[model samples]
Target: MSSISLPLGGDVRKTRQNSLTLLINRFGVFFMILVLSGVGLIVSPGFFSSTNLLNILNAVSYLGIVAAGIAFVIFCGQYGDMSAPMTMAISGVISVEFMRYGLVPAFLAAMATGLVIGAVNGYIVGKFRANAIIWTLAMNFILEGLVRWSYKGTQIYPDMATEKTYQTGFFLPLLAKLDRHIMDIDLVSRAQAFNGLATTYPLGVPLVLYVMFAVMIIGYIVMSKTTFGNQLRVVGSSYEVGRMSGINATGTVMKAFMMSSLFASIAGIFMTSLNRVGAFYIGQGYDFQAVTAIILGGMSLSGGRGSMIGVFGGVFTLGLISNILTLVGIGTFTQKMITGFLFIVVVAVNARSLRKLGRDYA
Candidate 1:
């Protein structure tokens, strides 16, 4: 007996289509990055220099962490975390304030604050089916007000706290005698842990740079290899279908929100440490920046499709643009306008592409 075989034309056509899509997804952002890099090299004097390049990488590291967290929520087909900035601010302030007691205590306090906030957000948005954007944004404002009221719009500077004459108001003045270098930006800067180093050696990179890459690697693994990732994808693809398939859609979404907020907390801790000061506005504007980075990476706001590598490329591209603008003598206001314009263009193009795909499917 002879076995039946499917038609070759359909299979061949599908193979070609898949190949094209894969090519487009993998290379689209990278191509833009390359083009921007070339333009930088041609237009800017020191665009290709080691110093400038390292600067770009260092800057990208910070945004990369935040974007990674945001990507987690997007993976689960959730709205962006509008509370990320507040989460960062609160965590940083708590960490900085508690630093006077002990490193262990302060770090715990910070992480605990973050986890608690994450849980709240996760429960509200995921379990209760609250509006992610509106609820999170409301939470952001509440936290902001609370922080300002507690801190009195002041900053916590570790370096200044050490000096006897440099006394400042503390929520807990009793435990304000410990001298830990947790917020010592100078030491960290010299060590090049989280910040990109000015010096260059292929092997001699910063610890923070490694940390960013580690986050990306972990994100990629979680999204691509794990069972939770599969559930998230399924839920994101279709909530009703995922439920019918017996996937715990609510729990998965909650986990995604919790994880995203957790990452935001981490970003806050790093920001506070780097700045050597904990202010109410430490992570301001990062939420939108992360969103922009996600969109630039070609992830759908509707969720269920994206890659970590593309996110990295998106971050690097943004960093490159900022660096290039600064080098070319653009003012802060002008840079903001330019960034806004670029964001609008990218979003429009992405929306158009998505619509076209929808029509094709229809």
Candidate 2:
């Protein structure tokens, strides 16, 4: 029998082609970002302004944090976390109420609240094998009811700036010190430069953005580099296969849920701090937004493959698009319409990619 062989040049060309394919598959989102950013800059002179760019980053910081955390659950092949927004709202409200006790206590309380909710989600999803969508939706409703009943439709605006200043003698300076410590030297310098350019921007942007980025890096490392992340991936890809491999699929899923909730809680605290207020319906639809960002990040709705970098890109993309639309005088309805349309486009692209890959593998 004779076997056909390619020439040396052919082999080199094939390798280059494969490399290009891999690059595109891995960095397609960045390409989209470059295109979008270019368009934004060309169309709106304000788009490239340092102040506007900083505003966009700051605006999207909370969403990025929330989406990063929720990516865990989505990565595990779960439907969605309905209770995330409510958890955020509840935690925010609790933090406001506890502010008088001092920032540390209030922050702890908010995080604890998130942990409790996450535990409940994990127990129900993991131990009881509950339907994630239905259970989380019910949990969200329960949280909503609790908030409504507790607040009686009232909005609590905690003067966090005043409280922090009074407690620390200078909120901005203290926060700046904290920022310098948390963020790397390079980022702190850039943030300081940006702040100098735009006096109206909040200091929280640097601190919160750095924290979110750090969390994403940690999450990525955990998911891609650790045994726990491997187990979760296995469970997401195929529960039966994971079980056959001696992995406790249930336990893994539960842990994912808990982690997701915990992050959601932390995001809630930051959001509340930014607004310095909490209302009964404060976090309405935030869960959907997080899910949208996750999906747009190129994560499989079917689960098992994603990246924190992609999620961050999605968050920034969504935030930038919204800001651009607002700047262009688009109404809320139009913005929602455009967002939904963009989401469909992204998901459709992802689905097509998955189908092609599956066919190739087969």
Candidate 3:
């Protein structure tokens, strides 16, 4: 057979085509966002209002933070941490109970608690090769039982002790400084600073929303721009191959679980602050919600293929959908049905696309 000569610019054309395809794949969530937002705006005049928009952001802040953590586990090629919901609940309770000591101490104790749990999970799944799903699910149940039995269904709150700390002017002022840093405020007056930190800022953006934004940015950088990210990608793509190539597959996975728990602990603190109470049921359904958001963000369940920004988009989209449903007078049960349907569709599409990209999942 005679070999055919290629066109002179064929290589350049192929590169450009590949670049275009990559861009589309990376930002495909935006299309869904636009469509859903358009429908919201058309169906409800209040959908795009500044107040309503801020509400959506505030409502989704904790969920988004947890989703970022979940994305980390997915990136590391693990199924998920079913213990996330109970972890958040317990962390919040621990933080609230320890607040009698001080904010810093409480925060540290809560985070240390999360780290211990994460280490246990990492040791089991990463080191000992335990089944992720079964182990994490069992962990979830154990934590839940512990919380209920320990607290006896009593809710913990920042009581007179927290008030005393707040009145001392030390904690509140420090919190004010933190707000100034997060919001990039220029004013130095204590009143303004305290006001900025304690409640809604600027137009209506909650301080919690700022926390979500910060977490997302940090997560994106860690998962996309760092050497650790590269290792995670390789490990996630093929654990055996990564091991053969001298990558510390087990260590990377352990780090991923730790990071996930750390982030979840932070989310728990925020949730406690927002709700002003800590209970065993505080994070009852968030584990499932975070998983849904992660998958909806276009990350492969098989791992090694997704962007943090996509997960952000997924959280935003879910928030928008929930808000729209509430605005349009939909029932909570009906909304759940819609959300479940959409999740199935997104996962199916993601699986198909991954297959097209030559990724095989057993």
Query: Could you say which candidate leads in TM-score?
Result: 3
User: Tens-digit lDDT track for model 3 on 172-241?
Assistant: 3355444444223222342222223326565556777888899999999999999999988998888788
Model 1: colliding residue pairs:
193-208
Query: CA lDDT, every prediction?
Result: 0.74, 0.72, 0.76
lDDT at position 75, candidate 2: 80
Q: Where does candidate 1 stray beyond 4 Å?
A: 1-22, 159-204, 359-362
Pairs in clash, predicted candidate 2: none
When summed lDDT is taken over every stretch of 10 residues in candidate 3, the lowest stretch is 185-194
Q: Give the local distance difference test score of model 1.
A: 0.74
Clash count list over all predictions: 1, 0, 0
| Per-model TM-score versus the true fold | 0.82, 0.78, 0.82
Tens-digit lDDT track for model 1 on 215-326? 8899899988999989988887676787789998788887887777777877787788777677888888889888888878877777787877888888888898888778
Residue 156, model 2: lDDT of 61
Which of the numbered candidates is closest to the native, going by highest lDDT? 3
- Between candidates 2 and 3, which one is better according to lDDT? 3
